[model samples]
Target: MPEIRFRPKYISFDCYGTLIHFQMREAVEPFLIGRLSPDELDRFIAVFRTYRFDEILEYAPYDQVLESSYRRTCRRFGLDAEAAAIEAITTAVLNWGPHPDVPGPLAKMAEHFPLVILSNSDDRHLAASVPRLGAPFHAVFSAEQAGAYKPRLQAFEYMFNALDAAPEDFLHISSHQRYDIIPAYDLGIRNKVYLDRGYDPELPPYEYFSARTLADVNTALGI
Candidate 1:
């Protein structure tokens, strides 16, 4: 069990991969459709994922990141690089809904504390996804609004300024170490929860509270 400490004014989250199914690979898989061998397709998918993260680090718009990742991945795989392929992947991201466990615990948590989303998504994309979480968010801060993406201190700074809340005032929860926990820790956020969804390995030195699922998160909070 993870140790829980410090009740927060708000519980901030990373919506996409943390709460939502974020079916980027599932969306891209059909597009491959025998263009590449199974092993090659998997390798392409991995490359696309890496490129997406790398793209975000460059401070470009989210759509550009998605498009460039698709183009680059296709080029690497010797596949036909087309605009439609990128569009399909971007569309899939906007249309994704929360994971099965997300709505219940998120809604329950919202009843007790304010819930906020700090996602590396644009406003247009997040608009479709946030409602699917089945919870009333106190605020949804996006990368477009921040003029930067996550893992950047500026994004969190924008969130804190918008909410008029300090770093110590909220419990930040996310599944991505690069995007959420590492940066949150650097910003002096003491109440951090690592929702381990297997995207990254745990680094104990970050000193975050860990939960296997949203249910574990709720239990840790004594909800």
Candidate 2:
């Protein structure tokens, strides 16, 4: 892990998984349990994850993205794609809680820095999810507002434009390296935190420090 070298103008976060619970697996498992056996279930899950990643390459309504991802993933695994199942999983996003360790430390971090969220969610959905983080945010930006989604450069460009801030001005944090870290780094944001929520493995030359949890930010940043 590297040290947090500069005090940033803003501390930006990716809401899902990094701060919010991001229980996509929990929300979708009901649709697959009886359909696949223990062996097939594992491959089904991997494919689903892959499909979800594929779904974000273009801008679309978040609900449509979820439905299309699920439908494509299901078809790949030789399963029926039910619209109601997709609806259930999409709706479940609103009720996810914070990671158990999130609230207290994040609230403390907010005291020392201006907090912001750059989420790949719809406006109405983020309204319900953001409050669950238990800290007041300086700004909460959504894909619905930005008209783009992450792993795509336009998404961050939209966010940068909205915050009226440049890449180097903030310390961006996220659990998904593919979604946030690579894009942020390419855009000239050097100060970054890779929160380890186990979505992807870390690699060097990625140009960011690592933290196991939100509480570690205090010590890592010398706050």
Judging by lDDT against the true structure, name the best candidate: 1
TM value for model 1: 0.95
- C-alpha RMSD of each candidate structure in angstroms: 1.3, 1.2
Worst-scoring 10-residue span by lDDT in model 2: 1-10
Runs of candidate 1 exceeding 4 Å displacement = none
Residue pairs clashing in model 1 are none
- Give the residue spans of candidate 2 off by over 4 A: none
Clash pairs of candidate 2? Answer: none
Let me know the TM-score candidate 2 reaches against the reference structure.
0.96
